[model samples]
Structure formats: structure tokens, C-alpha cells
Target: MSKKLTIGLFGYGVVGTGLYDVLHKSKTVDATIKKIVVKNKDKKRNISPEHFHYDKNEILNDDEINVVVELIDDADAAYEIVTTALKKGKAVVSANKKLIAEHFEELYELQKKYNVPFLYEAAVCGSIPIIRNLEEYYNNDFLQSIQGIVNGSTNYILTKTFQDNLSFDEALKEAQEKGYAESNPILDTGGFDARSKLQILLAHSFGIKTVPEDVFNVGIQNLGDLEIKYAKEKNLQIKLLAYAQKRNEEEVAALVIPKFVKSTDTFSTVNDVFNGVKVQTAFADKQFFYGRGAGSLPTASAVLSDISALAYDYKYEYKKIENSENLKLTEDFNLKVLFRHPSKDADKFQPYFENIEEYYGNKEQGYFVGDISFKNLKEIFSQNSEEVSFVLIEVLH
Candidate 1:
């Protein structure tokens, strides 16, 4: 906090440019971008050519730059940049969820070893300030569960499908056209994006470390008119949800999957590109966080918050990392699910269910409401040859 805060920025993408604009416009933060490293120097941009640097070393080697902001898309490259900056004893802020989730332990160790701040508030629900809230406000509270619609692309698509009565493909196309989805949106639609965000939250909320592969994740790619109709008939709304719940003092359950949300529930009302997180704690019954989950400005605002905090020498203690030893992740909890498949495939799933509440079938498709353990349901889906679709039934506490 002696000299003016100098920034070493990586990536000149949407969020990166937005951050630059915000920083330049702000009168509070005494920060200036020393250098910006981008992949392509030939790409036309509004920024001056003198401001861009093709070599990352230009930023990494500069002693004046005490803070590095990484807004890159590639997780691998982002990892390299962030690790390098942290090792160099510079404060780092990133929006890369995949990189952070995959290397949480390594990054925490780097923070301890180098004694520098590594903050990533824009990684989870964009502009929601969930991470900071979990790190500060809920630090003393015993959190029982964290559940939400974390991805905006899938949420927009689902909203379109439900309200506009559009098909899955049509909804996806609309999301793409509106810039809510990527050209190749597999990561977003397949639930991997939300899974990564959930993993990051698990560390802060429940003091647990987990990977996307360990979580039971299912995408919305298989949802069709039939499933949408079913949800409407049952007076429900379908949403892609990510959850982390404490099963016991020592055990926690986590997953990212589509669920049938009750029409009356708050989550059901969360539509379009809006995101909602419901945190259940021991003292506080339930608290909800809502915001625009994605977009350049909204996401950039979160990243800027971390940057501003860094200007004040703020760094996360990662208290959860110290208390995570006894927290074990499991998928053994029993849940009520509605499974849909071809009529001929009904018998294959029936044996896995502990109890069946209702069985309905037709020539084209069949579905059943039943109770099944998460482990068994995941196993059944994994072992099956054909694609299987299932949605978690909303349970009111």
C-alpha cells in the first residue's frame, strides 16, 4: 500500500476489457495496468497496442506489478499464469473455476508458501458475492446445505423452454444467439461448469475438497418435450441445480444435476439468466442470494471487487482448508427421483428403486417416481448402455 497499485493482467477477453474500463473509470482504487498479456497481438481491439504484451514474462518479471488478474478462458493456461504469479509473490485474482477447483490444494499451499493473496470471487455465481460471504459472514455459522441454480446459460435455456414452450434445441439456439451460451456449449450444458463451481463452494462452505468426477453430475442435453410436459403436468419447474449438503458432522453430499422444482419454491421463480443460491445454516434457517450470474459487466464487477480488496491488502485465510480433514464427501443419501426411459427399459431401473410411488408408461416413453440411493442411481446410469434421464423430486423441509 506504499506506491500506486500496479496490475499485471492476462487475457484481453470480455471480462478483462470490462475490468480495464472499470479500473480506469474508478476514482477510489489507486491501481493502474502495467501490462496486459494476450494470446494474439494481431486481434483488433480498442485498447492501445502499446498496452498489450504477447509475452507473459513481461508481466511476470516486472517488479512494479504486485497484482496479477487472470481472466483467460483456457484452464490450463490460466493455471500456469496464476501459479507463476503466486510463486513470484504477487497477489492473484482469477475467474477460472476449473483451474481453481482442480488445483485448490496446490493453490492453497502456494498461498501459504509464497505468503501472497490468491482470490477468485468471480469463479462461482457471478456478481453474487457468495465466496466472500461464505469466507466472512458465515465463517462462524454451521452451514448445513448450499443449493442453487449456478449456471446462467442453462437457466436461460430452461426458462425459454418452459415459458416460451420452445424445444430444447430451440432454447439452446436462443441462448446462443443472445450471447448467453458459447458456440460449443458442452461445458455449460453438460453441467461440468456448475460442477466446478460447486467444488469451489464445497471448500469454503463445508471445508471439503472434491473434484467434478466425484460428484454425481447430469446435464440437460437429454431433456425433451416429454420431460417438460411431465414437469408442467406435475405443476413443477425444471432447473439444473448444484447442491452441497452436510449429511452428518463428518460427512457431506454434493452433486450438480437437473431437479424438478416446485412451482411455489423460490428457485422455481428464479428464471432467465438470473441465479439463486439458498444456504441452510444451523442458526439462520435459510438465506438466499440472487443476481445476474453471467455477462461481461456483472462478472467483471465481481472480479473488480477482488481486485479492489487486493488493493487494500485483503487475502483469504482459507480457514476451511485447515478444518477440512474430517469432512468426508459421499453420495449415499437416499432421494426421491423421477426416472424416464423407453418402456422396455423400465424393468432395468425398477430393480434399483427401493419404493415406487407411481408407474406410468406409453409406447414412446415411460417414467416412474421412486426412492433410490444416490449411489445406486449413479451406478444404474453408468452401467446402462442407452442414455437415461432422471430428475430429483423437490422435497420440502
Candidate 2:
């Protein structure tokens, strides 16, 4: 682990290019790039052609390459590359959240079996070092809850929609144009991306391993004028929040949904492409972590930090996971929610949610504020997804 790192980098996309630039400019890390794997050899890149390779074996088979950095977009392909790299006894670094989150257990097993370091600090919150803090800093503390706006693209879109007076579509278009969002932005807007990240965090934050599907998630895609108007009237802002809290002594509840945040709340000030994480612990109280959540350089910086840590023989020990024999992931909790829809569909929902706390509307449109169990929330969302806008009402004690 002390020898100079010979890196085999995969995918010369945005993050890849940024990593190359940062590595070359960095004088502290004693690492050199041996080869970079790209899908299309025909695509013109600024780097020398000799550094790029289309075949994965060229790096996988190279005994000189000691580190493998995987930054690809495809989860399947990234999985193949990472497994091959780890099996070859090479330390691995990756920033693919979807790949890492979906295959976390398998990858953890691989790292243990092969006895190699596999670090992915950029997978969760871009430049924020929440993963490292969760592993090293909060190792002994009891966590009560972890919540924040983990998705930057949605935050940017929401900021524009609220502050800039732009529609959701317009804000999304701007984000895509600025490289803040993907070409197919469903993963970001649909809450799937945040859910994947939350899946990874739950393991570190609460020692709970759960699939992304198991976590109840509702995105900002269904957001419209009705929800925005209501929030403005209430002097609140809407943020797509990822939440994981201790429901009791043994179970932890997790969800990714839009929540109504008051202007005085700390999360309300976390806008645009910046990411914010609020961790509530037993002894430390509340701690805040904030940084750029998107863009090439910010993410690449995190990747670089992991690469640097490799020089010191640093790898996540996953202390919380080893001690989590009784902890479990659960959804047995009630959430205060605001449901807005057209007046015509009122009956479609009222029969389901009998415990309505408040109701207001006319012939054209209407809404209700009440509490719903996680089970019923999922059922209602599945049936009336297009007709309703559901938002979590953040009630302070």
C-alpha cells in the first residue's frame, strides 16, 4: 500500500476528466495514471490518445496498476469493472452511487474476501465528508435522526421555482444545460437518486441495510403550482428531503420525500446545487455538513480525497455495521402529510385517509392536511400518483 499508485481509470466523463486534471496538478499525491477506459474511442478528448483504452483488460491485467478508479455511469458495467478490479487484488475507488448503493453488501463482501480497500466518499453527497464522519467521528455516538436535502439537482430546481419565479420545467432545463443534472433527469427528479444515496447512508448512519425500494420515496416530479402556492402562503419552502430516524430501540425508519421547511429552518437556507446534511446524535446534539453536491470538480475532489487516503492504508472499518445485530430498517410509523389535488378527486382520497386534521377547497381544487401511516401512504401514492401532491409537514417539538 505504500508504493507509488499506478491508477487505471475508467470512464472519461465529467468526473473522470476532473480527476485526471486534479491528479496531474496535485503535487502531494504520489500517483500516476497508467490508462483510462472509455466506451467510445472515436469521441474526441483533450487528453492524449495513448492514455485512453477501449479494452478493460488492458488495465485489469496490468500488474503495474495498483489502484482502480471507477467513475462510470452504467451500474452494470461499473459493477463488472469494480469486481474485476477488486478480484485482481487492486485497491478500488468509485463515485458511482447507483452501483455502490445497489451492490453495497456484495461489494463489501468482495473487499473483505479479497482484502483490498474499496472507498466511495463521493457516492453519497459529492464533496461533503458525511460518510467519513459517520464512520470515524460518530462511531460511538447514538444517532437519533439524519435528514437533509441530499439531492442537488432538485434543490436547484426548487430554488429557481421559488426565488426566480420560474416553472419546474424551466428550472430543470437550466440545470441540465449547466451540467447540474443528467440528460435523463428522472433519477434525480423522481427521488430514485436520493433514495439510492439514503440506502448507503443508512448503513453508515444507523447500521441498517435496506434496499432502495424498501425505503418509501416520493419525488418532486409531481410538484406544481398548488404545492408552491400553499408553501408560500405558509411562509415555507419545499425541499426533497432524505430522512432516516430511529423509530424505537431496535428499528430505523427511512424515506425520501418532499418536506415543508420553515424559512427559519437551517435546511431552508441550503439552496441550489449545494448539499446539506443534518445529523442529530445523542451526545453531540445537532451537527451540520454542507458543500457542493454536484459539478465535476466538487465530486472529483472527494474522489481525490479517497485516493489520497489509500496512501495512508486507510479504509472504512464499518464499526457501526459490526455492532448492529439488533438494529433493523422499518416503516412502522405515521407521517404528517399535506395532500393537494383537484376537488374532483377529493372523494378518491377521503375514504382512505379517515383521520383528516384539516380540509379546505372549493369546486375547482382542494387539499387536506393529516397524518398517514407509511403503508397507506405508499398505497395512496401508487394509486393516485398523478392526481395528488403529497408533502411531509415538518412539525417541531
Cα displacement (Å) at residue 253, model 1: 1.0
TM-score versus the correct structure, for each prediction: 0.97, 0.96
Predicted model with the maximum TM-score: 1
Model 2 clashing residue pairs (backbone): none
Pairs that clash in candidate 1 = none
Worst 10 residues of 1 by lDDT: 388-397
Clashes of each: 0, 0
lDDT for residue 218 in candidate 2, whole number 0-100:
85
TM-score of 1: 0.97
- lDDT for 284 in candidate 1 is 92
lDDT digits (tens) for residues 1-397 of candidate 2:
4558889999998899999899989999989988898999789898778888899999899999999999998999999999999999999999988998888889988989999999999998899999999999998888899997889999999999999989899999999999888889999999999999999899888887766667878888878787788888999999999988887889888889889988988999999999999999998899999999977889999999999999888898887888886999776777777888788888888876647888878777888888777777778878877776655555411
